[model samples]
Structure formats: C-alpha cells, structure tokens
Target: MTILLVEDEDRLAAALIELFHAEKYLADHALRRAGKKTPVLMLTARDEIRDKIEGLDQGADDYMTKPFVPEELLARVRALSRRQGEVLLDELRFGDLCLSLATNELNAKGQSVRLAYKEAELLKLLIANKGVILSKETILRKLWGDESDAVENNVEAYVSFLRKKLGFLQSSVRIQAIRRQGYLLLEEEAL
Candidate 1:
C-alpha cells in the first residue's frame, strides 16, 4: 500500500515518511496538482474543526493534526486503504483471465496467482481499458499519482511483471506496447 503525506513541514514530513517506510508502505510527499485516487492522509499543524472539515472537503481521504500518536496515524491509514479496497471488490474478467480485486488474485487456465498491490492495480487499469492505449504518463499519474519522483520506468516495470504473470497463467490476454503510443491489452489468437 502507498500513502501520500501532504505536510509542508520538512522535518515532520521526513519523520512521517520514515515511519511509513518502516511500516512497509510506499510513502511520498503530496504533488503540486492533486486528483489522485490513492488514499491520502493529510497531516497539518492546523487543529481546528473548520480546518479538518476543509481538508476533507478538498478530497483528503483522512486528516490528522500535529502532535498525534503514531499508532493512530497508522490505524487511520489502514482504514483508508481498506475503504479503497472495498470499492474494488467486483471481479474483472477479460477472455480466459479473471482478476479478483478483493483478494488481488489473478486466475487463468486452472491456475491462480497472487499479485502485489501495485501489480494488481496496474493490471486492473489495463484490463479496464482493454484495446485502448494507455500512455506511460497516464499510468504514472493514475497509479503513482502526480508525484514528480515517479518515472516512466516505474510503469514499464509493473507492465513487465504483469506480462510475466499472464504468461505463467497461459492467458490469451496480452499487453502490447505501441512504440511511441503506449500499451494496449489485446486477446491473442490461439495457435
């Protein structure tokens, strides 16, 4: 799972980022431009009712004030992750492959394989937009959000992993790279 820290304080941001990493979460600072699907836990020095309300109203999935306990912050982050996962419970199917969003498992040809969070998310995006080329920039922005640190190589890595999983499952679905365009999911003909 990933967490975006929007705290402007450098020292606080570093400490929180370290905590999240220690907890095995992919954590990063908030981007300049928002609109990320990833669950956000906004941390700020403002500790007023109106401030919290405004943060939530501005699209933060969760909000916390300064001088908070680490345990509570972790718990809130977990809750947000759970909530996001709940929305993806519906299974996605394309050709002979089935992706279970709840379990993050992919099944095909009598075999089932588990996927990491990012891998499952990337696969879902590709499958959802089947036959449509998704640009590297789009994938980065959607999956990794607008974090400037994320690069095209990150998208390529995940796509490579998904391709290996598909090959292992012997699925007809293929992720095709369209040179300068991007990637598109295609069902291959049986030989």
Candidate 2:
C-alpha cells in the first residue's frame, strides 16, 4: 500500500505521511515509474476533475483531495486493498479446483482455464451467493441493474456460460438449476 502524497504543502504532507505510517501503511512520497504491482494513492489539494483524472491515469488506484476527512480516505484505501486481494486469492476452492478471482484464471487438478467477462461476473455472483438459491430475478437485478429491461433469460444464458467455463476449468463446484426455483452454487461435497 504505497501512497503518493503529491501535495505541495510541506506540513500537511508530513502529517498525512505520519498518520498513514501509524496505521501500518507502507506509504511513500513522490511518484515513480509505473510497473506491475503496488497500489498507489494520490493525495492533493487540487480539487479539479482534471487533477483527479490525471492522478488516477498516472496509475494511482485512488485519488483524494485535501481538506478531506482522513477517515474517509482511509476507508477508500482499505476498500481498494480488499478488492485487490479478493481478485488475487489463489483458489476459491469447492473440492479439487480453485477459481482465481484476480485473473479470472482457473486451476483444477493441474488444468488451467480462462473465463469471459460475463462468465466471471456470473460465477462471482454465484460464489458470493453460495448455498443460497439465487432466483432468476435476483440474479438479473444484480447483473443488469434493471430487472425490467433485461430479460430473465439472460441469467440462464450466463449461468450456462459459467457452467461451460467451469467445466473447461475442471472445477468440482457446479451451478445447480432447480426447476421453477432458481440456481445454486453447490460445492462438490454438498452435492
């Protein structure tokens, strides 16, 4: 969690650095050449949209303006960290296989597979709702944000997509469809 405090104010920057350090954050000042890895956060007094965009475009995971509440900034930073970690976890395992949330990469008994965007989203939703029978309406609402506009059949299509991807990935977990009810993300052992 390296934070790039780009504020021109010496005293304020120093205080923020100290505060982040106290929170066990490995924060640093100044920007460096971007490469793979390390979350960056930019803090500046510049409230302009251009400044915010520039900061993010420069590889900062999050950007904050000055005179902001420190707690709010901390919350944002923590959320970003959690999201990143969730994506990278090696295996969302049910039995013998695991789903890579980071890359949508899958590994099962030595086999590896990639998931499409919609497939991954649907799989994630199912996993999040593991053990719960997710109704078609509920799944549609979650995916398309509007149940009325998007047909319920889209959920069925996506579930099929996920099942195919998971099969290719050799995952033990299965998406079980209950007639007239909905779908459930069932672990191998549970089934």
Best by TM-score: 1
RMSD of each: 6.9, 14.1
- TM-score to true structure, per model: 0.54, 0.53
Q: lDDT per model, in order?
A: 0.80, 0.69
Weakest 10 consecutive residues of candidate 2 by summed lDDT = 86-95
Which portions of model 2 miss their true places by more than 4 Å? 1-74, 77-91
Q: Which candidate gets the maximum lDDT versus the true structure? A: 1
Q: Residue by residue across 87-159, what tens digits does model 2's lDDT show?
A: 4334455566566656777677789888875676677667655788989987765555441477888888888
Clashing pairs in 1: none
